[model samples]
Target: MKRLSTLLLTASITASVMATGCIQPTGDAVSDAIPTAQDVRVNLPDSAGEAPAALGEVSEYYAMTRGITRGFNAGAGFVLVLVHAIVQMPPTTVDGNTYTWGPGSDPLDPADYRLTVIDNLDGTYDWSLDGKSKFDPNAEFLTAVSGLAVAGDEAHRGSGEFTLNFTNMKALDPIEHNDDGDGTITVIYDLENRDGTAASLEMHIDGTDENGQAVVADYAYAENQDGSGDFQFSLPADVDENGSALEDIILRSRWMADGSGRGDARISGGDAGDEVVEASQCWSTSFRTVYETSTHPEILPEAGDVSECAFADQDLPELPGV
Candidate 1:
């Protein structure tokens, strides 16, 4: 998470330098041509600073949830960092409404790497990152990333969709240099509403995990003006020790500015057999469990007092892809 914050700051500085140094008085300014890092990046709630002294025990479940949150942020930040480094450079050529930045534009970029940005003339822009093909020696360039951004009100300039095609990029660069997984991760975001209030962002991942298993998941996050936020995601199915597929899992969590939060989880299908299990857990500012309950006691038994929860079960948003 600390690394993600650093990357965000670096991206901001890079964008500022590029905007000031490269953009000219032409009708199309670089600021208006490309999406800002904040416009497309995922924003999750911050974790509590330090555990309280009064809480003797910490909640492992809350810790796992926090880890997952950090994982998503880091994964998304990695692609955004690369995109900012390449696109923020001065373009090598501008043909009509399209701007092209080739290898020499950025010393850090590969000799074969190229980035193109096109103004669609309809309040939208399209961009693609291309690199030399590794599989086909005769092929010149293969697209690794592509996206579109819709021009919105002043408060929400770049609000649209973008995709990172890891499978294609991995074919050119090794998985270690590109991404851990193979396939695509699409992000859709709207930074603000018509009233200028913070809106929502979503990510859909259709890919293979590091272990080569198929993974299909959706994540949604909404922010509140008071620094509180909500996060929801689906857990990909896994196989048990006996090689039997486990159930599908969906979890939603909400946190306040003080770091107290609650999470609700639903498990069904596969190894869950015929019954659907529902569970809820709440943690304090110290990240210690205050209350926990489950419909299926065999899976998760009740613990503590519900009165300690900051938010009720009904407060959580509907689980995505439920």
Candidate 2:
């Protein structure tokens, strides 16, 4: 289970820290039955931090909408082939442009699964699956593109860049609470050297969470020549109750080769005041998990409490391709 979570994180950084769920019944187990993503529009009430409402407000919303750009990659592998094969849909057809499986059993359309792969012939391809009645109304419409090719290995056999796009995702059945609204998220993965490792990636989100408050963010990650990388993010000012810009929030961190890293965050406005906080984390390279961490080392006055730094302490499982 720990390794599964780590593999999910390796898919992209956005997946690492974002938590998705909906408001539900009492116990945690009971509520998780439905995989619902949170509507980030609903944020902390301004009263929670009566002090100028700048840093506090920005931090609260950033924390709320952490997982807006996930879910699409939940089935990242060759999902179309796997899904059809699992259901025993054979009599499959494969051509340069398309792949069709099944004459599915009754109630299931014979061509229950059909995939269209368009080879751009430029070291890239566009693939799409329209899974009508697959999971829900929109489950089958997932689309992806390979921006570049990666060198294949014995463990993992695939080439090219990886990118996917999902829109209006109401089909996911995410529940809303406290007036949070729904929105769309896009993910782009850039493989720096075609070595099957992502050199950098970016996620753009423009949507409202459950709170109905407008939320927007641009997050980017890049690798250094030394095998280390950094994650940086920026949040546009959210609207106040009176419809005015709250404050902008910015965060950046650099992780070393050993998975140890340092980072900082700040909230600023039109010269109202600025709140800054610094953080660091150390991970056990052997175990492939975070072992220790700290936030707000400088103790800048009125920086408020630094948001908790999180590290995955789970054992990483060997995914399909190492």
Candidate 3:
């Protein structure tokens, strides 16, 4: 079984030493069978000199809200993807006064931040598009990655050594905690450590963001704006100022529910007139997909059968050409 924790470190967090930074219960958490932070076992870094002394607060723990956890899982297990803008820097104000996160003149630390994942495989979750579901990061995905981890251990993370080990990381396959009506996945970046430790970074599979909410970002023909019509676009010359070859006409649309996980919006680009997406931005655009909930094999083929497949290596023609 994989360790429950993974990775997440943002630009601001990296500025410090750099510096650093789920889910619980089944459903609405009718059963208070959640795990407490104090009751959990974690590994703290060795007591150093300036690092430990700089910390004002030591250890902390908190509980996870389902909504927040769902956001985290939507990040597609990539911390960098979610940290879109720097937003307010660390030590940024909350209500009005400075919202002190942890230690240091800044808001994050790097030398001492570790995520301890407490994976409790209670029931089951399905992140599949069709209907197939499996066990994945377990409750920890939704629990620890959310509020509880920060509220509880935020102080310890920004500076001092904080270890988060979710020993119970076990689930069916890619199935995780939250369940959006659509097949979209959320890749959360709750952890922010420039040089610290990323115990669990592979939790997110991949997804899209409709304005803000994450969803199963997929591909469809594009002729117009509403995701219906034709599928052809034209570009201006000198599109490749950087000279990246820039041959492929890549397009992207974050299939995230708009308004912070409420509605769905397909921010796509085809032959449509909307040309806000310059060529440079399109380079990062994902053409196919990495992990797909829509294509999970009902029955995983035998190991030998998959190994023998030879045509998999050849660059098969794009779906368009076919």
Candidate 4:
């Protein structure tokens, strides 16, 4: 379903916003705590906290969601189309300022997704599927937008909202399940720096899955000079099968420009209330391979490894207009 795609798109936007050029801050408390680049040891909790054992599933859900929301081909409000994809189809028709896809083409096909972008001409533009297209048959979750940077910096930025309501949304990965129900996700993205500098990106998603379970998230990203950064993402008060409020779920990480980083995933307030279930290997430059530190062995038993640090070779998603 489009909901999964939208979720993945949000994740990609988050990574791109964080990877923008290094920006110098007048004074940032978060930067002060970062170990000097020469320090190889990452400071983290030696053991798990008081979070409940059930948090393992919550953390996995969030992790799987993040993984699902990465690496989409996009450009601001415009769906960046590859020249090859356009060439393989019949000639496109131009009417006024809009371009319509040829007949019998699947607009949702990554290669043939049909969309229309209307430039407002005042440093802003609107993007959406063609009204006549099947993607908008019922006129739901139709458009996205982009414009000035949220921070008034030289970096490009865009902000918009999307509503996803699909009964048959398919999960792009085996670990992910399309159990999400009708809902909306809002994203605010900052243009990445062409040069190293600080930038900001944020997102919020609130809705229920098919099972009617509440799905809520708050994500924030901040960068320091030298292209290093910090991030915090939380999913608060997810309900367990027994209907008790599980603890607030949180994932926090810090990284240096040279690929060294630290991270911890914690669940606070559930049956096992308040414990750290996942943590990274400090001083290690590896990406996303975390160790299970939770007292509850099954919180994330299937998570063979937990690595969140991005490798130097990892490319940021292409935010078309930016």
Clashes of each: 0, 22, 54, 33
Model 2 error, position 312 (Å) = 26
The C-alpha lDDT values of all candidates are: 0.64, 0.34, 0.21, 0.37
For model 4 the local lDDT of residue 1 reads: 33
| Candidate 4, residue 282: how far the Cα is off, in Å | 4.7
Better of 1 and 4 by TM-score: 1
lDDT of 3 by residue, 153-219 (tens): 3322211112111111112122232221222222222223334433222122233232434432212
- Return the lDDT, model 4, position 191: 36
lDDT of 4: 0.37
Q: Residue 108 in model 4: shift from native, Å?
A: 12
Instruction: Residues 1-322, candidate 1: write the lDDT tens digits.
Output: 1344234334443444454435432344444544555544444444556564333456544655676666666655555556656554666567899976653222332325566778787877788767674346586777877877676656335577778787766665553344367878887877655563766768888989768899888888777667567788776343122457766667778877777888887867776678777878788877778887778765567888788887865443375547
Ranking by TM-score: 1, 4, 2, 3
TM-score for all models, in order of appearance: 0.78, 0.44, 0.17, 0.45
Candidate 3 matches the true fold with a TM-score of 0.17
Judged by whole-model lDDT over C-alpha atoms, candidate 3 comes out at 0.21
Model 1, residue 15: what's the lDDT? 45
Q: Write one digit per residue (lDDT tens) for candidate 4, span 129-165.
A: 3212243344332222221212222311222233322
